[model samples]
Target: MNKRSLRTTLIAIGIPTVYAVVLRLLFGIESWANLFSVMTVTFLFCLPTIVGALTVYLSDASKARKTSYRIIAPWIPVFLFFVITLALALEGWACWLMILPVFLIAASLGGLLGGYLKARNMNNKLSISTLVLLPLLLSPLESMIESLPGTYKAYTYIDIDAPADKIWRNVTRVMEIPEAEDTGYLTRTLGFPRPVKAELNYEGVGAYRKAIFTNGLVFHETVTEYQDLQKMVFNIKAHPHEIPSTTLDEHVVIGGDYFDVLSGTYELEKLPNGIHRLHLYSYFKMNTTFNFYAGLWGKWIMKDIQNNILKIEKQRSESM
Candidate 1:
């Protein structure tokens, strides 16, 4: 390539890269900021000369003077120069940032080639590599951004075999396994421990009383709402771990639908065979206001509890 052409390549590719990395460093305490940076970088690269050319091309319009692709000719080199600069700037971005430049370059070049094919009215085989790639990268960037949040609700249709009334009987009824297979800390630690039966205080309002995990993680959770067996909302005021966060003013979680730290609140839905779906959605903040003290053992205990709930439910259904 000639000296000017080489310079054009570098500028077109490098500036946005640098801006992206800098913005990422500033905003990315977590993955949230990185996503924003990715979008900014993409937009800045695409907008520079292309948008400007489109703007100016439209602005100076007269009946005798025509707006044509020839006017956009100068923008081609200017746009490519900026794109190279943007690409060079991206060297500082995270490892993931390097993937976009090549595709973007091809996309920019592809547009130019498409314009060539348009006027000639000939079968021009467009570079499929660029055609299929730039948008794909943009898609993943958007997807990762949408996934940053802690939790959200998912809706799906499920047909249950049993009637809502019969399902409600099974769901509302908490099983109490009196004759457990095993005995104390050992019983709770190892074998089958007695099941402490739980029932909701109100039809669609208060706690269903959550499951009893081996660790000191049990809590009385109240329902936010209940529509027979169709749905139930509840909050868990759980001490997920035996220990607490080492901070001043000590994080204290109170029991109620909304005010609990270590405790997790969620919803459950039963549809029309024997199918039930659980929704673990929460819109709560975690600051020094309530320190989370999830110990290693506590995490294990919770996992076990979650798994065991299925087992307990299976046993209850079979017995019934």
Candidate 2:
């Protein structure tokens, strides 16, 4: 808690905190459930800079620069702990990503310490190295965490009584759909934002349609390929977060905001006693900002579609 140590603590804590506050004030806006607000606050509160700074200040760097492996050689346990925690928590190989970068940082920082200690022939200098190592590593790591964009999801299904052939007839007929009323307003399937509208000549591939929203959220969904009852594949413009740049080229539609395509099959299967299954898969990404709270809004909206189909199509099941 001496002058140098206190100064180190303030610098580590202050810089990250000030940046967090400024960013939040300038650009961070809270959505439905205040998910970003809470996450942003929590992230800033745990800024690791202070911890790394203290480690550096306490070490006797006078001899710190001389030592070849002064801190890292002994701190293998600490490195292993973070690595293990990351691996266990993150899905797939994402966890291990943090480890190598941190290790490289340690090697360079601790290597510098190693060189210093070797030159001066100094003894143990634990404090300074510990502080310097993590900041050199953790700051970049933390920034990456903050920048990752959230993901969204949605699902909808419809059952038809007539043969699978009849169902396929109606599925691809975009113009044939009923004007989405108070309820049928399914995903991007309905109202379709602003100047953008479904192209009337959209008989097949290469069809480009746009949906514009007032809040600067426009998305474009393009039809890549189309075939009879087999499959329909489409590509959406990348999510705002998919790239380093923030402002998307234009807010045409809710491609990622809502799903891009509604795909299904014209096949038969067993649903119940003497009943055939006309199974279908609606492909689309939910158009909504995800946060810890407020749950999944798009999914809830889609649940209505499932209920609608079951309600509208229920009479056919009973009649059979």
Candidate 3:
């Protein structure tokens, strides 16, 4: 590459990356200056847009004219920012995985805007400066707005060629699950702890149960309603303090400040074909300014965990 192109590449990639790292470090501090937060709309949405705009604005005008270049070039630096944060432990893999889609899209939009300004030969310097400083100015205001907690449900089911009684037995007290038996695609892909086993002392209302997972994560459950071989309802609680810090990212930790699982239910329905359909569902809460997006991931993760357990229950019940 020529010196001018190389310079454009470095400026496009370096400036945004440095800005992201600075913001990340600033957000990590705990004090009155808490406006720079990682969980806010500014960080998740605006920062990436600035990164993209800067990439296009700083690029050589000739190269920026290509429609494909405008869209894809910004992603390189955003991806580079992702790698740097993960490598430095500034952010966790799970958190990055969740925000990656948003970052890429916002960056592309920023690039398009940059391309437009370049084509018009607008006052690019002033515009780029404003965009670069936008997050810093907006985050404090965004943080001032209180995050409202929202409750959501993730429901899943599986059909088993077994009697209700057989399914109930497995549902009430799950045996130790072998690693090979786990099939939670999303959870496993995101590095979430896998289900290990669950133990219930008895089968009735007010019964105590413990659901164990890998990496020392545990869910304490108390039966609230019960119908023999038909339905079971339990309140689920996971103490963030009890869970190892390495098990989950703090931003998405179960029972943490931002997200939690509230309860779970299991119902068995006998179809006329003499098959039992086991229904599993869980209620989860998310307290974030961006619940509209975070809730989607929350539901997906809960369903994956529930479906994993349901699959194991189906196999075990059918084998009986």
Query: What are the RMSD figures for all models against the true structure?
Result: 16.5, 14.5, 1.1
| TM-score of every model versus the real structure | 0.32, 0.34, 0.97
TM-score of 1: 0.32
Model 3 residue 51 CA deviation (Å) reads 0.2
Per-residue C-alpha lDDT of model 2 across residues 1-320, encoded as one tens digit per residue: 78985675455334433432343343233342233331232322222223222333334444244344344432332344344443443211321231234434543454454444345545534544443343335433443454333443444444445554444443333221233422344433432221212232364687664423323444455657766544444554534443222222111223433233233222335465444444433343432222332124334434544344433333334343
* Residue 76 in candidate 1, Cα distance off native in Å: 67
* Global lDDT of each candidate: 0.39, 0.37, 0.90
Question: Tens digits of per-residue lDDT for model 1 on 1-320?
Answer: 77865554444334323433343344333455443333333433433323222222222222103334323432444344345544654322222232244334433443344344334434433432343234335533653543221222222222334444554554555656453621223224423233465555557675465654332335556676766656665665654243232210121222222123343433346644656554333323222111122122223333444444434444455455
Off by over 4 Å in 3: none
Candidate 1: residue 241 Cα off by (Å): 14
Model 3 TM-score relative to the real fold = 0.97
lDDT winner, 2 or 3? 3
Highest lDDT scorer: 3
Candidate 1: segments with Cα more than 4 A from true spot: 1-164, 178-195, 206-218, 238-301
Better of 2 and 3 by TM-score: 3
